[model samples]
Target: MVRYYGIFFQEDGQWSVRFPDAPSVNTCGETVDEAIEMAIDALSAMMVLGRKGREYGDPRGYEEIQAEAKDGELVFPVMPAEKAMEAYRPKKRINVMIPVDLLDRVGEFLKNRKGLDRSKFICNAVESHLQQNVEAH
Candidate 1:
């Protein structure tokens, strides 16, 4: 786990955080503590982007970072609780073509269902089918 120093700035009663090592990484919150929490999420996303771009950089030293801080800007350590990609699991949107009759049936099934949707139904059906196939094999 890499430790990056975050520079916290308060403006208009909101606390915002910025990482020097990653200029694109930033977050804001109503309070300092909240901002720190958001910093973890922001940093994790930055790590993922860096990995994808193949342009990741090492964290700068605290002394060096502190020296660059402004008069009221607070410098502190911000480390992600988990690995970069593990911290954020982005869902992918897929477009699937189903028979007109099947799509109509799905709409009817979900019409009265309070929480269930067509996508969730399809996912559950796929998972159950996969499990059954695995067991059969």
Candidate 2:
């Protein structure tokens, strides 16, 4: 998952924040604090909308649920593009067992048409699952 922020300054001396991947949101403040308050309100409203509309292709719109906020800003889960790339370098080895049904389902994933080792497939799956629930502050 990628999280990006955009700040827009209004003519009325207010500032607005936005999530590029999520256009439904725009937070604004009168002063920086007030605008931050308003932006939080906007972020909340946008989440409600995303949930209702099933944004991000998740019926629960769980991605819209942010982590506990910090400094009045709503944050979503993500890896910086460069850091994410680094994750693939010098990976370690581990093993675990899943239920037969679960393993079968993972095996059925289309992206692994040719083949997908459990580790790589699980990594991708975990990332996708995290996008649905994990978030930052």
Candidate 3:
């Protein structure tokens, strides 16, 4: 679990949220709840990028933030929602060898579908198979 400190403030009739730990991440919404939800997505995306080798800025100290916050600004603790984190997590690449006949059959099956690549199709199929087997057990 990763936690970061965020500042929530109103700007031009919209609620905006930004994390001190990651200045590059920010989001805006019409309501405070929406803003918080968007902030979680933004934070999770940043975490995903960081895991994929992106550098982030240093986090500000609480005292520094206390001294820096202006009127109407509120400090809020933010954590990435599990769903967001899972959805945004970086994908890993793997090498696999398949029989030529099977590969041709898979390609023929995907020919009618638009934008369904082999890797995604195989990943989804494996995941579904695993889920069904686990549930059966």
For all candidates in order, the CA lDDT equals 0.85, 0.52, 0.81
Highest lDDT among the candidates is held by which one? 1
Candidate 3 residue spans exceeding 4 A from truth: 51-54, 57-63, 91-137
**Best-to-worst ranking by TM-score:** 1, 3, 2
Candidate 2 residue runs with Cα over 4 Å from true position: 1-10, 51-54, 57-137
Error of 1 at 28 (Å): 0.9
Per-prediction tally of clashes = 0, 4, 0
For model 2, what is the error of residue 67's alpha carbon versus the real structure, in angstroms, after optimal superposition?
22
- True-structure lDDT of candidate 3: 0.81
Prediction 1 TM-score vs. true? 0.61
TM-score of each: 0.61, 0.31, 0.60
lDDT of 2 at 76: 34
Candidate 1 residue-wise lDDT at 56: 49
lDDT of 2 by residue, 3-113 (tens): 344344453666555554555655666666665555545544444334345455322222444332235444433223443344434566777778999888776774547
